[model samples]
Target: MTPHELYADLTRSGLNLIGQALSIFDADLRLAVANRQYQAMFDLPAELTHPGTRFEDTIRFLVMRGEYGPQDDPEAAVAFRVEQARTFQPHYFERERANGCCIAVEGAPLAQGGWITVYTDITDIKRQESLLRARSEELSGQVLDHAERLAAANRELAATNAALQEAQRILTRTEARTRQVTEMVPAHIAHVDGEYRYTFSNRRLPSIFPGAAGNVIGMTVEQALGAPTFDAIRPWLECALSGEAQVFEITHPTSGRRIRIALTPDSASHGVYILSTDVSAEVQAREALSHASKRSLAAQLTSGMAHDFGNLLTIILGLQGRLAALDLPGHAAQDVQATLAAARRGATLLDRLARISGPREMALQPVDLARLLRDVATLARPSLAEGTVLDLAIDLPDGQVLLDAGALQDSLLNLILNANAAIAGPGVIALEARFSGEWIELTVTDTGPGFTPEALARAAEPFFTTKKGQGSGLGLSMVYDQTKLVGGTMRLDNTPRGGRVRLRLPLRPIARQMILLVEDDDSVRMQVRGQLTDLGHAVLEAGSLAEACAMTDLPGLTMMLSDIQLGDGLGVDLDASLPMVLMTSLPPGDPLRARAQGPVLTKPFTQARLAAALAEAGKRT
Candidate 1:
């Protein structure tokens, strides 16, 4: 038999037995043939369908739903199916119905001219394929999701690493700052191990010893320092090893100098931190001060005794004056008057001696620095050598200070006289005063050859002098001692042009004498008020010149004591006869100096002198 005849017979027999559906069609839309399986499945009565039936119509009849396309484009699916079959040579397709009918359609080319299309009712197989496709899509989505999660985890890890690096950088910067602070510290610092090995030391440690330049780490203290100092430090080292800290002083052998040393325990290595400081200069200064203090005490004792003796002489002189007034025998009375005169001269000598010693009992009172400055200028004029002239430029505040009047006046005279003697030719002697907080400061500047270094060093030392024949060497020393007694400080130095002495003494904040004190600096006004109260004077307080001026019209206001640099303006309009004293913290050359009508006083005057000046003013008024 022929191959085509055999295939046709086998196809027919297989379709009948397996209830399979089969179809054959040309490229044109026509029903070529249908197998028995196809007829049995759709319940067709005829083996062959009507001629000229479109392929799309047959496909729509087989498929209840429009799975392919609209009825208007029925030929569109036919063209697509043909093209698919041609491209793949053969293809398998399945269609499913909503009511559970599943069909697999397979098209393959026949050896004859046309092709055969077979439709098999594989409902279960097609259903399984669809379920498997959905599961595969779900698995693919899970893979994509997992990939995104992994990418996000990678980004988080990178950010964490970056943050860690940033933290490490901050820690490094903090450590660097800490190291710089440690190195720049002024004190000596060092660390040593149990075996006396030097662990660490700051930059200043080497400067203190001058011997440690090379690396000091790992060298025992004894090996590095060689002997006694190392032995002396052994106990301190042992204390640190025993977990205890120690602080002590010892003399170093190399420099043979006393040093203060401290040891602290280091927990990391059980070592010790050694800190040593040089106190040699401080020790010497303390000893010198102690000696000078002793001398001053002795001088004070002598002065006290001499002062008592002077009081007794005063009584004797007073009695003699009365005795001389009495009319008596001429010879006897003359002899008694001579004895009294001699006793009075002796009393004057005692007073001079007491001045030489540092006088103990002093009547400290608020003194007008301006008046004292004027008096010193007057006293120094007569002492100026042949061609020399003394000049005084003063800005004295009516402000009073608490001080020993006689001693301060004497000190001022000495300074002025010294200045006059220093200059060989005519020279200007400038005296200036100003308020400094609670103290009044006076500067006496002289245009003359400056003091030599030797003289400057020994200026306040007793019995030390540059003047060969004329100086007793006790003038400045007495000044210094007196200043100390009054709780003041005096500095002698060479100015740009000549020699100068600056004296600072605490002043009473307020003056109670029939005057009003006005100042912008509240502390200064308060201090001046306190000084006035101390001197038994009543001081009216105002914060500014305007306030004081306003009080001028007010009842019971006596005198205006206002600062030149007042809140409103300079106190230049103060009543001239009302005893207006311009108070200032500025020096003499200050413009306010010329504007003030009454006497000006710098800040920081002693109590007694201020009261005397005020008393004199009151008497004049």
Candidate 2:
């Protein structure tokens, strides 16, 4: 027999072992389960005792047999009983059957519809009562009668108590199930009363907002969420309490995460329901998309104008070159040279403008930040005045983080050059790098005259330079653009010591290790090997899964990057100790692709995308 059938048989046998009769019916009024005692007590036929027998049919049979002591109309009596069963409620009663046997009936409604009924025979107790009334000379007639009535009442109360206990059990299970569902959700689900005190919570506050109290059942909103977060949403809370629903977003001051909160008014009480979710990733993605759209529009508007302007600059340069080649008078030659210089400066300005409005993508890769910063200082020192000193202070955990090294290098160089110009002589230029939670912060400070109010407000705006005719003013603007494209932030401020420019970028650290590359195609394998080499990782190539598996025991092997479909076997069947990333050309819905145990990359991908996939694999490991 199947396990399910065996379990059912065991359950039936146990139910039949009970002395009392028990039966269950479904919402459709069909018999679901009945103990052997139930069938024997009613003398029911085989068909009537089976599952799916209608309760109405059973009632009609019993009524026709005079089980209720000869009802005037059997059909009418059956109809009445069936209707009462349809609206069944918890009940207890005692009745004497036509056979003169007494039984106590207890029925309780089920949570998922239908009801359970238990019948206990009380014939022996009834006989004891009759004997006491007929033969006991020590007891008065009135006292004996009162005693019999009290015994029947006590039995009814006992049956009622059993039904009440069953109802409590069902309620407890329901409450536990509801709590489980709410806790499993990825957000905070809570309710607050009119006093702004929390009444119920799923204990998920800490998961959504780091450092939040796990349980806030009796705490006020301000106390639970902190003063700053509470103040930010206080107006919305008031509106919700006044029967108006609200949905809004805010940045948590402590964790720097974006939170989306929805408050719904409870119509039946002076309270509000709350749902809070962490939407930091969503907000970052949306901002990145918005910046990309703006860049596309700028490129379209400037591409044509830039083309025409470039042609004009070329003509001017060519004519000026021809003039300089001629044997002209000395004074006239000097004037010509001056004119050429101005025209050349205009060409340079056009180049900077093109860079500002051009389409570019962040090529993120693992970079040694300390090494990058040292290189920046080495390059900037030669440009600084003789008295100027470049100082570097880096306080960060030991690791390489994902960054666009070239872009960051250019931005830092520009800031250092700008700071050098700001200082007259003998000033300290300090570069500091540190960690702030999931972000890497870099700050450049100079001991020069701090920025004026206007410069502080517009330093990052295009063509808003402090240098009158010497600066192109696109340096800070380009730096700001690059930072925003990668969901980073740039801030300009004036400190007591000097002017400061701070940049904060997401810190995604990835470890460099030897990797196994598995692919059936030689050309693809070679191409991927070159990409890995460029990212500073040693790669070992294999033509199939069997070859890859043979090298799994190699020393210093840290991870694997493999194609899903291999000649001998699938890459997912590899050992799970080493982190893995899979690449495939299979359609998204393909079963093999869906079976990928780690991060999956599409077949045609760039070095940046591969770096990202490897980083994700590292996180999973």
Candidate 3:
């Protein structure tokens, strides 16, 4: 063909063969020729299209990098395309559209001039390529990991094979030795399948059960024992199959012999090994020990219950005395009062029994030892004989001691009554408390006959009492328990005047603050006011919040003491200047209780406690 004709033919063929868009540039990177596909692919603006348009200018107009940005490396892309054209190798470039479809450009140099580039819509191919690449990367990582693991497994297998060979040699010798030893031992030695089928048994099996060893191997528990012993061993056999190792003592009724059996399952070997030991002597000893423990526990429970009952009786009798004094003219009043009193007394007795037999689980709270002592003395005063006078002289530091209030009260009441009973003349039962270093020391002094050496030594032993006919002797034991529960120590010593039980409870230094006492009950208010006043504080009394709020003039009030439900109603206005402490008998978690701002001291608290809580609040403030 002629040169001009060849050029024309080549241009036509190149434009057609390029597939979509064809573009060529000179070494200087100027636009030479662009096919119809090229114009359409770029959405070439008619305004910038002319014969001599610069390639770089065209790219700036045609290309947007990702979503809405200019191409970052346009110059470098041009340079790379130029290099590919000069090198005579086909060059490929991927371009993406706004719709996420990708166009692949396969650019090649035209033999006549410039470059020929084909545009292929390769969005699907690109997506498949991405998935394939991700899968390949994952598979490659897995293959590398698998190869390393396989290598490690080979090494482990080799080592295991060596160990197995050595173990096999040792096992052969052990089996021979085991068979010899088995025949010599008095007890039968045997192996069974996971299904409990007998795999092996020693000669002793025949002696234990005549002809039992014969045909026992490869036979089930039922087959070997003929359904009798199998019934006894069935549960254990099932447990073994479930992969549990069982060791138990069974009594053979027919043999009348106690035997200890151990069965261990081996799933890999599909068998369970059985070991039987004669334990008739051990069984008898254990039975005897169990019986003795039960007797001891029963005695302990009885004494504890009796002592608790005594405390409850004292409370009931006190209430009953007060009830009897009241004028009740009608039959209904008398009968109802009598019935109620009887029921209360019965409940008290039952409570005592429950406390003695039940576990001594106490919910511990921070308590003042001095306050607890005084309250106990006052409660027991009503129960004391006419001549007995209870004196509580407590001088403890304002410190918190962990304790259970009910149990402590019971212990104190028991001691006080015991003191009243002991004294023939005018009796003085003094509950004295004081802080000594890290402990609060409590001494119960009685003007009675002092404890003997034996009595002092056995004071805390349950059921060991001097008042044999009258006492259960668990009073001091309960006291001992209380002392231990609070991580404290107790001592029974002869006082200069009479008998004294000294208890020292561990002290935990807590924040001290002033307290506000709010109560409408006159006796309760007086008792609490006196208690707080004696604790050395500026005691502010408020029967209601109006009275509580009236204390705004008291410049140094640290806490506002208020009742949860006052004589009028609940106190809604909280004096923010002072922390509020509620003194109420209402159960905790009551909605009214939530309205209070400070810690609550349940009603019927002693003066020392009111003082200590106020002091704690004062310190925190």
Ranking of candidates on TM-score, top first: 2, 1, 3
Q: Tell me the lDDT of candidate 2.
A: 0.89
TM-score of each: 0.35, 0.82, 0.30
Q: After superposition, how far is residue 90 of candidate 2 from its true place, in Å?
A: 0.6
Using alpha carbons, what is the TM-score of model 3? 0.30
Q: lDDT (CA) for every model shown?
A: 0.68, 0.89, 0.66
Worst 10 residues of 2 by lDDT: 287-296
| Tens-digit lDDT string for candidate 2 (241-293) | 89999999987866768899999999788999999999988986775566556
Ten contiguous residues minimizing lDDT sum, candidate 1: 62-71
RMSD of 1: 31.9
TM-score of 2: 0.82
Winning candidate number (TM-score) = 2
Off by over 4 Å in 2: 69-74, 135-146, 191-199, 213-245, 264-272, 319-359, 374-393, 412-432, 443-481, 484-503, 520-527, 587-589
lDDT-sorted candidate list, best first: 2, 1, 3
- List model 1 lDDT by residue over 1-621, tens digit each: 999999978976875676667776665645666667766766543523554556555555543345443455656665665455444245454556455687666665543335566666767654564575566765676675576456445544554454456557767888788768877875677788777788886656555554644456677777765677778878778987788888887655454345778888987887889887876556545644863675676577666687577778888888888888899799979987897978877776565445655336456765666787778778778878776666666655556555677888888887877787787678888777777554568778888998899987678876676778666566777777677666566677897899988887655454455677778898888877776777776677778666776777666666666777777777776556576666666788787788766666766654454554454445444
Question: Tens digit of lDDT per residue, candidate 3, span 356-456?
Answer: 44555554455776777767766788888787888878776676655566777877787778778778668788887776654666678899999989998
